[model samples]
Target: MQKPEPMKDQVPWATIGLVLLWYGTNIGVLLLNKYLLSNYGFKYPVFLTMCHMTACSLLSYAAIAFMKVVPMQSIKSKRQFLKISALSAVFCFSVVLGNVSLRFLPVSFNQAIGATTPFFTAVFAYLMSNKREAWLTYATLVPVVAGVIIASRSEPSFHLFGFIMCVSATAARAFKSVLQGILLSSEGEKLNSMNLLMYMAPIAVVILLPATLLMEENVIGNTIALARNDIKIVWYLLFNSSLAYFVNLTNFLVTKRTSALTLQVLGNAKGAVAVVVSILIFKNPVSIIGMIGYLFTVMGVVLYSEAKKRYG
Candidate 1:
């Protein structure tokens, strides 16, 4: 008898464990960063991002050299370096803008706004690929974008700068996903996720250092205050950095092992989880319309993913 074909979306228990790890660590980093920047009063998103990049760079190197967690892949030429540099810049912008928005908005509001990422992703995917999606797919994003607009207008803690940065970050994230996939698939220049991270993290360091210096002031003074207030902030920041690494790692692992839609579904679920946990932890005031809009946005993500699964 012939063996049955393997299911593309079948997820083993091990993969589920990684998904849970991804969820926990993601929430941990968001909450920890918010605490440090807001209540803990660190107030340096660029500097904080620079630190995470530095940590990930050093740790990525160590993993390759010492632990052999990922085999090393040399950047073969300047063209490859330039490609990696561009990817790194887009990645940096997405993350740093996210970190910056925390200073001006509550975590719940930030995440509700963030749930509209699929809208941006859909828009960029069409523009770059020039592939027209099914009108049903396009219709799915309408509510997602509308919901975010409603939430933004209704959020009690909304700041114009934060709102703008968050929206831009969402678009950058969407663009990066599309561009990174294209860049990695280039002829004779494929890199696995870990190798990509290894190369990209250093470029991020170079890019972020100048931005941090230009955008933030009195880092040394703030560091002293943060440390003196609670040395535990330092410890949590280290943990946050480490989680950032694992988040990237598990993301790659999840994609390689499961169906494409699995990750996107989990991504939508993560946005919902982040919004709920943010509300509980931060106790931020959200208007009724904002809650309604948040739910609409999340539902739109689910419907959009399902629509793609069926038709796209």
Candidate 2:
């Protein structure tokens, strides 16, 4: 008798465990990033992102080289490569924006707002796939928006520019999620999430280099100078960046192994963890409204997750 064909959409229990681990690892990444930025400065965040991406890119390159899995010749079309590269670049930008926000905002608030990515992603997915969404999904939007407003109360330096940037950053992140889902669904190649991430760093560096030079204090020269004076900062940046990538890669794997639903449930802890880290490390002030906001945000995430499970 022939073996039964594996169901592509079936989720496994091991993936559930992985998703939980991903949540824990992400919390660690948040702690490290918040600690570094609040204690140090933007230079730390910049260096961390650049260096971490460099390391991950190198590791990914090494793996591909050893397996002799050079960009699959079939998918080596310039147009395809450019498309993937563009997606990766956008991801990198979203990441950098989040990092920059960490410098000014509390981790809890940042992540609380960031969590809205799923909602935006749902909308994008609906638009991209041209599928109609269920009423339940739309219903959850009210809580999600309210939660964002609540969480915004604790923002350390809430300016119009910063608020706009943070919102844009969250939306961009949502876009990345939608794009990745589309890519992974359509692409037939052996492209793992890590592979996608590995391609991102180099492309991101290329895209952000000009901005770093013009907007950042002194770019490479300043970073180099700072590194020379404080080697600890280098280590901090390296560790934070590396951990962040690892967390993300782990998340993708976990979601693949388990159902996205499991990860969503487990990921609800990120905001609380982020909040504690911000309070303890940064001594960020929180008002009654902010606490309410956090609860609402968490509720929105839960509601959104359930809606997807039912309607997705």
Candidate 3:
């Protein structure tokens, strides 16, 4: 008897575990950063981005060095290198914008807006894929938009600028996800996660460093000083980067195993978890109506994911 062919979309339990870890740990990192930034008067998002990217780069390079996957000189194709570099810029930009938004918006507010990433991803995929959504998906789109509106209104007093910034950041993040999907599909022919990560890491650091220096100014030096004075910052930086990278890997693996829509919707638990943590810890002011709005947002995400699975 011939052996059955392996399923391409069937990820192992171990892989699933990684994806969940990615989602939960990502939420944890956000909570920790919010706490630290709030309690210690630290400029977090920017500082953390620089530290995390630098550390991830170093660790990723060390792994490549140990495994002998690609020597320093093996990136011979200028086109591929440029493409990864561009992707790195986009990813880093989104992260920076997100961190900036966190400075003004509560953690839950940022998470709620960020949850709309799937909607934007769906829109971009539909546009880029040239595929028409079914009537059900179109119907579900209404509730999803409505849910976001509801959640956005829950804030104490919305700053037009901050709201716009948060929405822009969310859209940038969505764009990054779509672009990553495209780039991964293309360069995946030649690059593994570690290689892509190793290559992109330096590019991100190079691009982000000058931007941080110009915009954040003295905040950068102060953060570095804090990092040295408190060894805990070092641990936080390591855990933040390593866990985030690992989680993203799991997200990628799970997408191969399951439907993107399923992952998007189910992964929304991150927003809910973040919202609760923010409120309990930071006391983010949320009215009853706003809480109701969050519930609707969660429900909409679930419904949207289910619809996509059926029709997609």
Candidate 4:
């Protein structure tokens, strides 16, 4: 028999669609979060995050069960459930803190702080697992840290508490990512991103409920009062929560279709798009130095992604 030629790779329209969908949902949720927390007078971050997790839990179930988007996964053991609950706790902490920070910080400056996630990730990896990256990879983080410093100094609406919360949220997010890998590294314990979300969402809701009740005084009463005043608040919560689920779904779909490096690069671009959109929509004042600093951080993120891809 004659040897056959291999087929060439075609343009990934599906992946492209997924990436665009991811961006839309991600940015939509971010903008809505800012609007709800800052402008809309919904100051309960834990409650807002609870709404998101509740939506995720319900949507994930429907997608897996009725829509058949992916095979349904169940917790195999108590240990696995515990691990997922731990992750959910961390996830809730990061999300609640991020939302809280949004109340006091402009989305652009917040995103600038968030762009330094890789720096935290690298640090956590080394501290937790003694993992070391190439020198170049570490060097790329210099600009990442420096940019935040410059932006913080120049930000017109800088709030120290918001900055601290954002940085802590970023660190907690990095820690969760690292912890997930450690907790689920074994083949038997591993779950796909969808399944992970499915499991984590409900647990996160459980974790957030008590915290919301304890930490946010009269949140339920306030929400009810707000709804009585403006029924649109309910609609906003519904829409924002739905967007939250889609954000996770599209993110997993995009990563599944493309390389993680591609997702990271796309994320860098997404942050810039978000910053621009938020600036236009919220009309938040941004100094020239602040913009320059954000650009530097984004550039550093891109370089870090490239360096990680090459070195790893």
Q: What are the lDDT scores of the predictions, listed in order?
A: 0.85, 0.70, 0.72, 0.94
Q: Give the TM-score of candidate 2.
A: 0.82
Q: How close is candidate 1 to the true structure, as a TM-score?
A: 0.90
| Candidate with the larger TM-score of 2 and 3 | 2
Candidate 1, which segments miss by more than 4 Å at Cα?
A: 1-12
What TM-score should be assigned to candidate 3? Answer: 0.80
Candidate 4 lDDT: 0.94
Tens-digit per-residue lDDT, 53-135, candidate 2:
77677766665557553442234556667777778777777777777777767676777777777678777878888666798
* Number of clashes found in candidate 1: 0
Q: Give me the displacement of residue 106 in model 4, in angstroms.
A: 0.2
Which 10 consecutive positions of candidate 1 have the poorest summed lDDT?
179-188
Q: Write down the TM-score of every candidate.
A: 0.90, 0.82, 0.80, 0.95
Candidate 2 Cα outliers beyond 4 Å, as residue runs: 1-21, 44-47, 63-74, 126-129, 153-159, 183-190
Residue 281's C-alpha lDDT in candidate 3? 84
Q: Pick by TM-score: which candidate is best?
A: 4
Model 4 residue 37 lDDT score: 96
lDDT tens per residue, model 3, 25-127: 7777677666565555666566667766886687778756885644543565777688788888887877777766766778877776776766787788778
